[model samples]
Target: MMPFSTSFASRYSSAAMLVFALLSAVAPLAFSAQPADNPQSPVLPKSAADWRHAAIIDIDEAYQLSLENHPGVYDTANPDFLKNLQAAKAAGLALAVRVEDAAGYVAATQAFNVRIHDGHAGMSHNLDAQQLPAERWPGFITVWRGDALYVYAAETGGPSVGAEVLACDAKPIKQIISTNVFGFQGRSDEAGHWWVRAPRVFLDRGNPFLVLPKRCQFSLNGKRSQDSLVWKALSQQASKWRTESYNGEQLEVGMSEPRKKLFWLAMPTFAPDEKQREAYRLMLKGLSEHRQKFLEADAVVLDLRQNQGGSSEWSQSFAQALWGKSRVDRRVAAYGAKTEVWWRASPGNTDFVTGLVEVLTQQKQIEGAQWAKIQSEGMQAALARGDKFFVEVEPALPGAADAKLDVKLDVKADVFGDPPAFKVPVYVIVPGQCASACLDAIDVFSLFSNTSLIGAPSSADSTYMDVRTQLLTSGLAEVIIPNKVYVNRPRKNGQVYLPAIYIKDLEWSNANLLKTVEADLIRRKQ
Candidate 1:
């Protein structure tokens, strides 16, 4: 993942400008704008057919990179995975051939990404490449609730909050969303994809391939009505509100006593920035200091609704702190014993890992840097040995003589420090947005006998892991590809963890969420 840098836009913009200048020099006519016959008419450049053909070549390069370096290409779990990818590539090329402008190109690429159905495989355009005319939105946004879409936010005179959206553009609302929104921005899990992208169903985010709705039907107060959609430019505040509504309120790493015997721990993010790392350390320290408080509580809610992903180590460390290092380690060891991992030893993947070592070292993440260094060296060694993959299999437990290991292990003597475990009932609040490291947290927490998962089902990821970004040959966009594949992982690829207690009617606001959980705990006790 890219670090949070203030100058990222400027740096990318500069690079885009350079690329644009080069393209102009190579094809001056393609770059030059032709004046319109009428002054009021919009001046248009030459058809982007030539540019589109060039982008097709770039896509071909991306396809080759995925085939050579991405673990997903070699996924045996999904027999049709490679076929689907090939089909998506063919579809994208066909779209590129027919597209007349940048908007169509964007749609074609996004459609390709969505069709792949992998969260880790996607394209990100550079800054200037995204400077096309702004996409308009109807004066409201909708969210999935129960089996229906509801108006979550709106401009003045738009649909009222809680109004059920029945249809848009004379088509059933669900059909419209599935066609326009999901068709362009969907990922692995259905619930998760909806949770993350449904809010944009009414907006056209620079995809001119689909028609924008001009009218919508709503059902409110037992009265059905069709309203003319007033299309308008989305204000910055509205965009912010839409994001917050979908993601729920932002949270920091902290614990709160929502009730006399209920503790709510907000772990909104596990992002691996230096600040977040320090915050996690402090949170762990706080947990240790208030260990008794958590132990005595009737329930402890570990809220991960807003967490997307980061380093999995954060979740593992949290588990170690709460469940005791020895217990956590034993479970982790057992899990690892059954799993195997293979890193693609392609030159590009090896170089990416080598670069990560330097980046992690500069960020003061010594542990991460060391891990990257090891991976880099292993990949280099594998390449030298003419091996396609660097394989690793976990060692068996002390007495498991029947266990067959695929790789040699450097076993170290275990020094067990068995801290007392928290005996209170624990609940992990997972929303659909929980993914990657967030899912890792669920993996660790689920190992405990006293813990239960609640709320919506979490998003899923394939065996592919450890992604690296590579710029396409066209310089118009970059592709993300995963370098390693996990074999025999406990959780199957594209599998979601369904909450033990699913609260379909629960509102995501902090206050309401706490109240609902508290009420649920009360009912459980009764």
Candidate 2:
């Protein structure tokens, strides 16, 4: 199963499935429907003007959805988000008027999604279904190391692997990346954003809006040289390598003895699928069996370098196994007291929650099923009462008379008893791409007294979450819209979590990572 952003909990809800089913059923009708004048009928663009007009309609629809449903638009304290939204819409419309082809129109719509500064809010289409032109890339890929960009991989006759890229087309390499890559993709002001998107600088992913560089200046063997660019079709093998490099090695989910007294728990992803779910269950069971060994270990490295996100509850379960459920619950309750979640009461969102309840129940995720049920009921009531949002307050502490556990997994009380107070120092390895439920994992680990973050700052998300998609009228793309907004959350939107111990110029390979972390631990004890 594919990993998703933090907004994945309700992704496969009945409402979403129903929408997809309807879209599929009506796709034929939409294609062969009446004249372009009919708003309900999909416009098959046969000319440049037709494509531009269709794109404008789609952009307007997306903008309206955001205004009506996105919680960020309603945040009075952050008026800039609204202002940016308006600007992006205007820019997209203006660009649409000038575009003469499908590629141009796609880039125009992408501008709106990019300016939102949100990873969850974007326009995406299935390339195979759309039969779009394939993406092209220069015969090399670059990665960020220290403060400079270096070639990580190269085809024969391309830049050397260790070469530092200085400039492209006489423009500074950083400037080129900021404009061509991040500008068309979503742009964020956070350092983690740059770190995550840096690798895409040299790849032209079918966006006609970008101007590919003609020549690049590279410094190798202490000598500077320039080479003319040669764009080639991106091969499947090359594409796979690029993705793996950016996301890090996909390690198995289990604990290991990396050293005599040091342990390593490699949890590369928390993707919520039957196989991954079973893997997490078995890992937790193993942790339970070896609880004493971990508690007495010198250090434990919770490796999350490649984790993008999935279900956050997986990480919470891990924390509960080692830190004790009562302790973790109390910490969560204290944090929850100061926070609230406001789910939009729109018909689509309410419907999504209703469907989510059924899906979670079938999956045997009792805690999530119960939470979805509460939200579904609350939203329906809010809609009936003419309220715009349904509010959910944090539950009281565990021992309180009205205390309710938000999430209770299948850990038998008698089998594991109350785990002793964990005293081992946990070093969490977070890469720049760590986000969504991955960020949730960081939050869980931080609650413990003996935890310290290492590596780089993690990518951040806004208070907006739990996304649902609406297909554009053109049927070529879909717009992702978030349903819930956090009120008084501990971390502000776009705020990254900085690691306590930063590893400078650290290589991301598995062996090097373990060696580096071990060396750091030893030096600290000196």
Candidate 3:
């Protein structure tokens, strides 16, 4: 039988699911709708005309004006070098029109990206984007019972959908969000995504999670009713539920006790690891054997609010296990003009001949050789004709085949083939800190059936391209390179392809997207 507990969170009611697809009665736009370019953002050059007519903004100059130009990068040599290269590119940033402050920088960057169609690129706001009314975040937290911090809540369809704050700054995220969201007003609650995420458009800035302090006090609407003793025990034992592993790619696995029937999984990276691979296998196996139990659960929450992303393999695995099918066909293709045509190389290997004279195009390319090499630029270097042979591979499906993409994946996402079958509702939780692979994960996963995004908007819009560069400074220890990300498609094609559910702000800040299924299962058993 099901026993009520105040500590357990995110239960599903068949009745609730029926109405879950709706948006909140109050227009979130009031707080969320801010003009492009926040005042706090840096002013950036817009058009080629502006740059030519105005002061020359070198990569270093632009660095001072970009969102990517932060001190944290300097904390370590690797990040510092990356930021320096990023800074150099920032100098040459093409703007629609330069605005006054940081908000303007972000606003113009986003607007321009949308125009050219670059979404995966990053954007920083200026005064203009920051001009929206300040929003308020809930101080308390609502955690759906799980191993990670995933606390499930309804996809925002109404005011009642959010978690109720029970304490003053009582959750780990509350403090962090407050600290990291640099431009946000104390009251600003814009959940952080751009208005339009198109090709070449850049958006998403700041690391919001690191700021969240460790301790937090909270309460659950449903968790308060059951046996006080056991419920209290669960609450006191809350620390045991907290777990994180930088070593593993997958995260969180738990069955909600209060919500009894729901199951939960929170993934935080695109990089899939061995443990994560095994956990996923086990999860699927468990579901197969307990199909009745699986079918019985009211909801299943997949929490990824803190997920930064790991691998394309994991994304596919996730689609298959949950929905039992995918629509994408698995084929890889690439189209690029190679001056050195005849020869094509694979991921590993080396040496190439560009009409014989092409020993190496750039010093960069030569230094970063994949494998083996020709003796020299000797014209005699006719296609090494040696036992040495390398296959050329480009993006027929860059975003489609994300394995090669670092900052930006090619268009289709890990290459061609689509996923099959996915009626199980999905709720993606994005935060202000969401970027790169994390944003890609959100965008790609949204294509599945019954999918909705909650929390904050993505820091990136899936637009534009960024050139990865490594700085040449003394501490420059790693390679800094930028990936130019261009948007490949339009937004809102159809309901099946859209986010059926969305949450603007976390009133209770509990992000357990799938556990709602488990919670329902438990309740039903009662």
Best by TM-score: 2
Each candidate's lDDT (Cα)?
A: 0.67, 0.70, 0.31
TM-score of 2: 0.84
> lDDT tens digits, residues 1-526, model 1?
2211111011112222222112212221221122334322222224687557755765676677677777777667667668767877876777777666667767778777776777667665543423566756787777775467788878788888888989877799878888788777766246766666666787766676777778888998998978898777777867876776675776777777776878777787766457767877887997778777777888888899778775566677788778777676566655556566677888877776676666667767555465556667888999999887887432232232344322233222233455556778888888877777688788888878788887777778666765566666555565767667777877777888888776555247777667667777788789
Total clashing pairs for each candidate:
0, 0, 149
Query: Cα lDDT of model 1 overall?
Result: 0.67
Off by over 4 Å in 1: 1-47, 128-130, 354-374, 384-386, 393-417, 503-507
Measured on C-alpha atoms, candidate 2 has an lDDT of 0.70
**Cα TM-score per model:** 0.82, 0.84, 0.38
RMSD of 1: 9.4
Report RMSD (Å) for each prediction in the order shown: 9.4, 6.1, 18.7
Which scores better on lDDT, 1 or 3?
1
lDDT of 2 by residue, 1-526 (tens): 1133332222223332223223223333322223357634344578888878877877887888777767777676567888888877887887778776777777888887778777766565422425445677788877775466888788889888878999988899889888887777745466666667777887765666778889999998899988898888888867876876674566787778867778888888876457766777888998889888887888989999778776666787788888887777656655544566688887767876687676667767565566567778999999899888888643332222353444354322223455578878888998887887788788878977688888777888767766666666566566776667767777677878988876544247777677767777788789
> Tens digits of per-residue lDDT for model 3 on 397-460?
2122334322234433433454333345455655444554455455446555455564445443
Looking at model 3, residue 92 earns an lDDT score of 32
Poorest 10 consecutive residues by lDDT, candidate 2: 16-25
Candidate 2: give the clashing pairs: none
Model 2 bad stretches (over 4 Å): 1-44, 354-373, 393-418, 501-507
Residue-pair clashes, model 3: 149
